[model samples]
Target: MNDTVPPPEVIYVDTHKVACNGGGGALGHPLVYIELGAEGTAECGYCDRKFVHKDHAHEYHDPSPRPEGEH
Candidate 1:
């Protein structure tokens, strides 16, 4: 059993909506838009990169409750 823990690739985002295309170039995929939603994080469908909001940097493990008045 491999107990190695690979470091998560986290991209801090300011906006709730983010577009990802696997960073383009050689290893890239079709563009897709990811919405952070209430969790304040979204993962790319192609590359599986984790997108985390700046506000939720500390509580990355346990996502905080969504802010009031947000859908």
Candidate 2:
């Protein structure tokens, strides 16, 4: 089966947003955001599968700006 996803790359941590997750200091998603650096293998935390390319990982990113036009 073939699924489409963005190619994996070395993403760097650009900023760390510290917000209180609903409770117990948990996070609804990953606690970090990264900037893609170079192409590489991508990993799926859900199934622990290694995707060699972006199309294989089935990952998509929305680079839309925030409502307040924040980056």
lDDT tens digits by residue: candidate 1, 1-71: 86744333568888898999888989889999999968788788778778888887676862334467652
TM-scores for every candidate against the unseen true structure? 0.70, 0.22
Candidate 1: misplaced stretches above 4 Å?
A: 1-8, 62-71
User: How much is the lDDT of residue 24 in candidate 2?
Assistant: 30
Instruction: Give the per-residue Cα lDDT of candidate 2 at 7.
Output: 29
> At residue 12, what lDDT does model 2 achieve?
23
* Residue pair clashes in candidate 2: 5-54, 5-55, 5-58, 5-59, 6-54, 7-54
Top candidate (TM-score)? 1
- In terms of lDDT, model 2 sits at 0.33
Among all windows of ten consecutive residues in candidate 2, which has the lowest summed lDDT?
14-23
